[model samples]
Target: MQLVALVPAHDEQDRIVATLAGLYRQTRRPDRVVVLADNCTDATAEIAERCGAEVFVPVANRDKKAGALNQALEPLLTELADDALVLVQDADTVLAPDFVRTAAVALDDPEVGAVGGVFYGEQGGGPLGLLQRMEYQRYAHEIHRRGNEAVVLTGTGTLFRASVLREVRAARRAGLLGGGTGCYSLASLTEDDEITKAVKTLGHRTVSPDGCRLVTEVMTSVPALWHQRMRWQRGALENLRDYGRTPVTAYYFRQQFLLGLGTLALACFVLFAVLNLSVNGWQGAAPFWTAITLIFVVERAVTVRGAGPRAVLLAALLVPELLYDMFRQAVYVKSLIDLALRRQEHWYAT
Candidate 1:
């Protein structure tokens, strides 16, 4: 079966070379590699061309990745057959030598429409970088353990059948995907989630393979992580509106419910502290909350074995983790508001 690797890049000169080098290392090389350089002020296109990829520079637009991907696919579809597999990869991710081969074999099954590989964090930057690495490693471990039970959330290292993509494109043309009236809109951010749901709606399965793997860089700073999470939360909220009332909508609702519970728990704890300060003393309820917080820390520590003892201990300290949770909740609330306002999502390099 013929395969194409599509890499969406924008101002990624620093990371593009390594990504291409990894692609070159793939055991089963794709028939073609297409790089969508979207509004890049840098030499991303030139660099991609130097790396031997067919580069396409798209017109600047609000839809960002989705727009660039749609434009890139137009020419690819004309050149390739409808049954070809298209592997969508981010510019920051590096695949294993056998990643493409594994994905191709997995998708050979008629029932599997899409497949994603395991994502791990690369190390050797600094303390903040190490923290981010540990966080991602923990997340990857959970996702890996969950296997195919976990929802296919992102497109960082994912492969899709061209037939499935055509169905998604047809739905987009009919205004059945995304939130806005147009076929493609800047208001929708999590296009991967939307497409995965669409594939499932068409009775195709999406899975994460056990052998396929990819390494990705994570945000090194807290502020960067916050912004990235904010965009994801906002995009997820926007995608929820499109799914509407379907049984598959439970995934979105489950995330919202968990966030709501977290928010309510924090609020109740604050109220209890305030009441205690007014009635009894400063020491009141502190120990109880501390114990409760320790429980969460312990759970996280047990859940993330790759974090090492030191990182797990740090997580147990609860000073920064609690603050992180608070920040996440705030981001979630703001993203919901942004979605409600129908504001355009500005894609930023994470």
Candidate 2:
């Protein structure tokens, strides 16, 4: 397979070199590296060129990341041969040595349209950074249990079969899919999810394999994480809205809708628990309180344990997990509300 790595970057001078360097040292190096230096005033394009990548700066769709990616990929994806695979990497993320090899292997089945990597958290920022590491490990472990079936393809280290991308492009042209974002669906903030659904719509599979691994930076602060997740949850909601009961995406749509309802129920339960405690003090709510404690035990022992001893200890500590859950729930509620209101788009640096 001819592997072509596509990186869409905007003002990423501070970190693009590390990304390129990692690609250069890959176990299965790409045949070519294509960088979309979108609206950069800095040395992003220059740096990418120096690293031996063919750079393209697209004029249209410069406002959103999905747009930039679509602008860069539009003509190329439709024309590349089926044996060619396109690997899309976020500018801030770094790949493991064997990432391309692993992804290439997964696509050997021919029916698999896309493959994504398991990501570890980037090391050493602070306590919050440690938490992010733990969070990613736990999440990755959960997804790993899912085997090859994936609801969404991560952008960090995703490889796409050129044939499937051509199918997606044709779908967009025939008006079978939304055209606002071009091939990548710029209308929704989470274009990755939209593209995943579109790929599935074409009777192809998207897989996540353990061997295809990478490292990603996490949001360092509570506010940063909140905004990031809010956009993600909203994007999930938007994808569901856009693709409603369409055959290929009906399962994910129902899943997210039910998840929203379940989340809303969780919020109500929390309110009721607080009210019960307020009305009858700690003694009457002991069982409820105890159940909450057991949740921490399960979370630590079953979930975050993979992150290592520190994560196991922290999950038992419960404070961080509880605080993070509160923030996540708030994000879900806010995202749902905003989507309900049809609020304007919000963008942030990756």
Candidate 3:
């Protein structure tokens, strides 16, 4: 039951030490900690080395995070036993002290192939950050509601069995999966989502236990949040396209369709509201809709209560969060349009 941690970093000098330190603080520390420093121009590698982590810098890896991970995992998977666990965590996230211990317990079940962390946003982005924090708290609520079944193996932090990863690689090579020969799909923009599909397709369950938690970086501004979500939404659509209507992708397809409907519903609501205001003057709200809105507000407030007083306050504000939801709905629509038009996606820093 050997445990190894691989942190994929690209110019993360500022956050590298803290991330590594979090790993060291784990209740169940990794037997080996390797930092995959991909094309780093900063002091990321040196800093990681100073913190006593083995740094594996990929040679001319242009495929982004997926490529860097494949390069490092190749040797490690080959060297480690089938039962050995490998944790692929983002360099910017800080895991809870019990993250490793809890995730390991979950993976102890042979049927569970991977364990993902329940993540919340780190502080300091002002209003936007608080919104993201509230959103993450809701996500955490959903995970709990679903009994820890992983909808997606988030890249923020996920633990995997070396055997399952090798199986994923073999599945790709044998044409059972679409990610080329590597464990991660080089062509997919959202490698995490694609890998979740791959794992489920292999008949393995993914879980996100409550004790396995982390605090991840959030978008600081509207532009950053927009770009980040665009990539996420678009990448998800593309992965669904690549996988096509299988049992593995059925839920994802439904999710996308619902997202589109949600967007359309919001747009229609705004349009009809303006039309009514111009034509009929300020008519009072209907009781049914008011009740519905109340229910929604209550749900929002309750879901974000774990995020503390400030988050609860924001969730209670209603309009601000509604505006945020409208913005996300727009991203969903834009992502669909971009995918339909076959527009190129440009990755940018948030």
Candidate 4:
């Protein structure tokens, strides 16, 4: 089967070389590498070409990454065979040398439609970056614990059978999926999450093998992280809303509800603590509560232990991570509010 890699990029001149290099270094290198340059004002296309990757610029596409990819996929999919594989990856991600090999192995299974990467953050975002790394580590541990059954086919890197993508497209056109008529939903902020539901709805399974690992860019600042996550959380809610209550979206709705419940629980806990402190003098912590807290702390530490000393230390400290949790909770709350009001949040380009 022909293996094609498509990197959808917008002004990624600074990192295109490394991305291409990672592809070239892959154990199961792609038969062809194409860079979808989406209205780039920089020399991203030139740099990609310099690195010897075929460049395809989407013509005046305003729908962002999803549109650019659709434009490129249209003609390319026509030329490729049904069994051919397409690796849709971000411009800034670097796959492990064996990523392609591992994902290919998983995709060889007729039951598996796509294989996504187990991604970690790239170094250099400071304390915030470290926190995100730890968060990602915990996420990776959870996925591993679940036997690599993926909840989403992350954009960082994912391998798909051309046939499956064609199926997704057909499903969209037939109104079996949302987004009207595309492999990805232009209306959905979190295309990955939306597409995951689409794939599953079509009776195809997705996997995230541990061996298929990659490093993708992380938000370096609080504002960046906030906007990124807001878009993610809000997009997910919107996607679910669009898809409605179907068997495929039942799990996603539960996940979102639990997140909202968690946020509310945290708020209630803080309020109760303040009220108790004001009503009574400082009372020592209860043994039962302390044990529960310990369990949580230990779970945090153990899950991120693989991230190294600093991550474990941070996770154990509790304060930093707790504050980060509060921040994320705030994002979740805001997303819900935005979704309720049908408020429009401008898409922020990374």
lDDT digits (tens) for residues 77-107 of candidate 2: 7567877989999888899888888889888
User: How well is each residue in 1-350 modelled by candidate 1, as lDDT tens digits?
Assistant: 78899999989999999999999999999888988899899999999999899998877655688788877776676676667988899998999999889888888789988887777777655555556666666766766777653365356788888877777667767776654432134356677767667777767888877667888887778778777887778767767776775777786688788987988799788799789789877764568877987788788777656756766776766676566567778887788777778777676667
- Global CA lDDT of candidate 3, please? 0.92
Give me the runs in candidate 4 sitting further than 4 Å from their true place. none
Using lDDT as the measure, the top candidate is 3
- On TM-score, the stronger of 1 and 4 is 4
What shift in Å separates residue 236 of candidate 4 from its native position after superposition? 0.3
Residue by residue across 100-217, what tens digits does model 3's lDDT show?
9999999889999999999999988999999999999989988999999999999999999999999999999999888679999998989999999999999999999999999999
As a whole number from 0 to 100, the lDDT of residue 228 in candidate 1 is 83
- Over the stretch 10-82, how does candidate 4's per-residue lDDT look in tens digits? 9999999999999999999999999999999999999999899999999989998899988999898899999
TM-score of each model, paired residue for residue: 0.86, 0.91, 0.98, 0.97
lDDT of each: 0.76, 0.81, 0.92, 0.91
Note the clash tally of each candidate: 0, 1, 0, 0
Candidate ordering by TM-score (highest first): 3, 4, 2, 1
